[model samples]
Target: MHSLRPLIALLSATAVAAPLRADAQTFEPLSTCVSSLRQELPAKVKPETFETFTRDAQDLRPVVDTATKTQPEFQLPIWDYIARRTDEQRVAQGRDIVKNEQAALASIQQRHGVDGATTVAVFGVETDYGRVRGAYPVIDATLSRACLNLQSAERKDHFFTALWLVQEGVVRVDEFKGSWAGAFGMTQFMPGTFAKYMSAADDKGRVDIIHSVPDALATTARYLRGLGWIEGVPWAVEVRVPPSVAQRWNATESEHGCLTQQSPVGKCRRVAEFAVDGVTRVDGQPLVRPNSLLGQQLEPSLNAALLMPAGAQGPAWLVTPNYQAIWRYNRADAYALAIGLLSDALRGSAPQRTPWPTDDAGLSRAEFRDLQAMLLRLGHCDVVVDGASGPKTSAAIRDEERKLGWVETGRGGQKVFIALKKSSAPEVACAAAVPASAPELAASAAASAASR
Candidate 1:
């Protein structure tokens, strides 16, 4: 037993050290992320090329840090985030960009099968139509993240891939400044993604994405093609599910891990059976079952996964394989959904036919303070409201959500905020209630409160 205890102690120490090792991932600074790689890189590059990468990486620090910390906390809700991109203003602007740049976008679509909407969405999202590619030094941020060697293996890969790009002379160090994530040019591709998908030649001889609009858009299309993007199928489609139905959905099974980034949803045992719209197709076709939906049909066969990010009462979607392709661009469902929805909006479609329950009322700062008071009174939270949601405020909001029959998204949303404003106790009150974390609701609640 004593021997077992020491073994257990050693195992615990290793467990603790593992996280420390992971957190050790830090910024390497552009110079080091590149120059250091010459020692291990394929020994074919000239010594002068290595020296050039070192110099370029050193100069890229300013650009990298600027991009990384520029928006440490993105506060836009899915609805608002999707809405802004798909709004009439943006759609009209996209149309103009497309009309003026048709020949270029069409040529790219022909070669890569990536449509203008996807191209535009990428351009709009990456740097707001390339108006702001970022003010950071790409080398510095890449090096910083690579050196920190923190909990990011993927980022480390990006660092070295950047070095490869320099050695290959695909892009000189001077012209390579971009986002901290190494997502550069109009389409925002990380160095590794760029290295993999960037074609050396467009219809024109230029392979450069930094200066050439045609090359960049085409390169983005190539990336989508490499990711198995379907040509004509929509990325995602707006769906209407009646209140009587409950739609249960899950992403395809993954041997690697869960389909989401926030937390793992566990292994997929079988395709989860979910509710569907009882109504049939526009042609008076019978409603297709979820199981049958997975199989191909005579019409355009689209393998889709239903997504309901804002709980059951919010907007719903049937995201197709192309949607997953967009998700491959960025793992966040919200981001992919935004891109997919924006694609639809750019094509001139209204919001989902299903009515979103958005009119539950807003939570003001004072009201939030009151909600915080109730939470602290119940001993679930020991922090002040201050009209801001730090960790404790979120904890309090989660406690409140569980009290009501609300869905427990840790981040604060309008529903949780409204529920907090009402201040009603479940049958058992706080003492008897089991407190659970609600990060999503508290996150949103903090935003709403702080704005006021």
Candidate 2:
């Protein structure tokens, strides 16, 4: 637990460590950053190669800046995070993939210790099962990240590695496009990670995660194995928190356990310790002494942390090493939890036992689309029915929230959905139409999105 202090301190510093930014350098004159990198470029990445590829790279300052600050992982409530990603609609899609792609996934699992369900969960979450692999060019994205944080060697490494990929013909220059952070392809592998885990899944002998599903899934399985994923071992299990235990630890959560990263989540306490302290499975079954195979293999030396994401009042889990491995894939609790729950959903396993501690539960994509449709029908906001909650949607939600005499949360929560549905179809069907508003008001089109 104590060993993570230095790293936590470093992360804290790096979060605000862009001292190179001056009042004048507004992240423009890309050459200022690109020029400074001549000496920092990896030995394999030549200057001519850098100049040839990045000369016309578009500046993604606006997108990258917003993305870094408003990443869902850092900003979203845990329930919203899990609910939005692991809804029944997405789960059904994943199960179909598991059924159809069983042979390919089975081959990859035979090679790597990762499972089809978990790998497909990553595929589903990262790019909506390869449907939306981002729009930014890899060079532009990585360069933008590097320019944003000049002190980050890792960011610079990513940029140079992106160049190297283009130079080495790992991917076509025109085809190297992905997320704002330069993670590309079906499973969203950054340039560096792509290099680390790039391998052909089948006997085709060519690697193309972008165009091929097997390559993408196999690459993901390899990456998970590299990160210490254990097949059949549960990543987390829900547990009923004893009132006494909750009372003792709830107040000081941040200072004690995974909430603060003071203690690593994977090594918080032995299962026996938790059982001694009155922790039990959701069904009241006692955890085995030190060794456990309750659902899957739980090693004797393994430790488990009680993760009450929304404090003692909400759902809790004893997250394990498999969860830690997923965390490495994307270092955020929201993201990891989404992957975990989505994987469970893929296998048709039990859903989350406890609900989030809120009257207005988070909306799924389908539910969000329903909310968007309501917004359009009632002339609340001109939001696109794409189901994504963007700035324009947030503005609309805030406006409607004010009209409803509710505190403006800008969330398309259950309350908002119900209220909007009621207003969209006010009872008194077949009754005389109350004097309609202006024709334009009645025909308002909501084409934007709101917060979750």
> In lDDT terms, how accurate is model 1?
0.50
Residue-level lDDT of model 2, residues 263-354, one tens digit each, is 44533766667777888777776655335333544543455666676778888777776776776676655566788889988886788888
Which parts of model 1 are misplaced by more than 4 Å?
1-38, 44-48, 55-75, 150-157, 242-247, 250-301, 360-452
Over 4 Å off in model 2, which ranges? 1-25, 247-267, 289-294, 424-452
lDDT of 2: 0.67
User: Residue 152 lDDT in model 2?
Assistant: 77
Best by TM-score: 2
Each prediction's number of clashing residue pairs: 34, 13
- Evaluate residue 273 in candidate 1 and report its C-alpha lDDT on the 0 to 100 scale: 22
